[model samples]
Target: MASSSISNAEANTNQPRETKFEKLTKRGRENQAKEVTKMEKTRWTSDAEQQNYSVKLVEALSQRSHGNSSPAAEVSHVAVRETADRLLAVAAKGRTRWSRSIVMSRLRLKLNPNKHKKQKKPKVAGDMRSKKPVAVAKKIPAVERKVRLLGRLVPGCRKLSFPNLLGEATDYIAALEMQVRAMTVLSGLLTGTESLAPQFDPLGSGRS
Candidate 1:
């Protein structure tokens, strides 16, 4: 009986020490978790800043409209638009870092950053009229400078071009509305706020 009592006391003493060691380990892990969370917050803040910069770049590029400026101004505007488009493409999602780097390289080749000052004439390369006498057209006649309203180039690509700044703003707002609608639908599914019924069930299990 004396030996059994001695053994019981030793066991009780060892168990408490083990418990204390475990508690210390758990506290260490909690501290590490806090450190990781702080680092993630910093990383997220940096990403947000980059995204905001990209958005501002897009807005700056969109300011180049036909009606607002002369053909000479349009040349400079095209340069800015092209450069901004390059940056926007870099900011595009679902692309590898290497691929984005390649795109940036190509853009750098195409966009002459030093060519910022307004040039002599418009840079677009489409013949508006069939054929013209070289000497007669040496002095480019002043044509109607009205920008095409709501210009759409292809199917499934809405708001492809806009006449002015207001139209561009409207296009962005419309895009935001679409995103909000998509988020609403997704939130409904994620939160179980809306029931999603099965349209057809071969096994007769109606639960979706």
Candidate 2:
């Protein structure tokens, strides 16, 4: 009997205790969902937190870009690609759809600097003042057509439905706002430094 009990205990030990996902009760499930949702909340929702994040983001950009590469590597000075990674980091909360779309698009551009090169402007298709509508253009609903144009503007949203694409656009706009704010703060700091002043003011204007 003692030997049988010992063997049974060993078998139980070998078996995984948490092998199955324990189904939560309805109330438990709701609580669990709330917890999960809270995990993805933006780190900068509060004013204090926003101020903190802005400071950290600028500090990070200064650390990453300072002395890491040659003057030529500052190609992103105009493109602002150097700030892309940090912007993406700030937007990463909740894995929002638009953030993902723009991040992927920008990442592709970052990996292929050639994509950033200015391309020859294509010839204008034709005059835009004509009041006579084309047959195919008349067939499409104005709302639908507008949505399609928005999809083109929001990267990775070509196939998304109108509602989803709007969500993406909203998020993308928010991310862009964050990027602008971050760049503004960083630029303010750099403006005071004499060494980098000329780069910002290539014309040699004393006041930036």
Model 1 C-alpha lDDT per residue in residues 66-106, reported as the tens digit of each score: 43556545436456545544444444331323225436555
For residues 1-208, write the lDDT of model 2, one tens digit per residue.
Answer: 9999999999999987643355346667889889866643443343334445555565555566675676445434543464554465454653666556656666788799698788886566776654466886889998888888898887678799877787667766665665565456456556764543222332223334
**Stretches of model 1 off by over 4 angstroms after superposition:** 1-54, 58-81, 89-95, 98-104, 111-208
Using all chains and alpha carbons, the TM-scores for the candidates as numbered come to 0.20, 0.52
Question: Where is the poorest 10-residue window by lDDT in model 2?
Answer: 196-205
Off by over 4 Å in 2: 1-25, 32-44, 63-65, 68-76, 79-86, 106-133, 185-208
Scored against the true structure, residue 59 in model 1 reaches a CA lDDT of 50
Compared to the true structure, candidate 2 yields what TM-score?
0.52
| Model 1: worst 10 consecutive residues (lDDT sum) | 148-157
- Provide the overall lDDT of each model, using Cα atoms, as 2-decimal numbers: 0.45, 0.60
Error of 2 at 51 (Å): 3.7
